[model samples]
Target: MSLPDELYNAKFAEYIDSMKIMYLVDDRFKMICDDYCISKVNAEKFRQKIERDFQHQLKHENLSKELEEEILIYIMKNI
Candidate 1:
């Protein structure tokens, strides 16, 4: 199933944030984020952009259970 653009963007953003945190402390995490389309500079930019765009309470909900499961498996395999 395809996700709405907004949902996909939000999920990608959340994943980026998690990766940034990990990247700051772990080299492996940095590698994973880079592999997944987020560079160190890009991750920082994403954080700033998210904060600015979502001034109010921003929540990310993964409605696609199958997609989520698939992503988890993919991440696990890659990591």
Candidate 2:
């Protein structure tokens, strides 16, 4: 699977080494990376909106956080 750029972004970039390892061996890890990227993009879009949708922005932010936690946990366990 192609790694998502979000995985290399500042937020999770430190885990790139571990993530790349898991990403190559586990499909689920790749899915989580994909989800994180999507949620991040959505959150940014909401942030940039002139008429902001705070609810949606918060939702995406929360999802991103949860997914980030999961990724961290997975990396730690598998590393």
Candidate 2 lDDT over residue span 11-79, tens digit each: 767888888889888989888878988998998887778346666788899999999999999999999
Tell me the spans in candidate 1 whose CA falls farther than 4 Å from its real position.
Answer: 1-8, 12-18, 38-79
> Relative to the true structure, how large is the alpha-carbon lDDT of every model?
0.59, 0.84
Per-model TM-score, in order, reads: 0.28, 0.53
- Number of clashes in model 1? 0
lDDT of 1: 0.59
TM-score of 2: 0.53
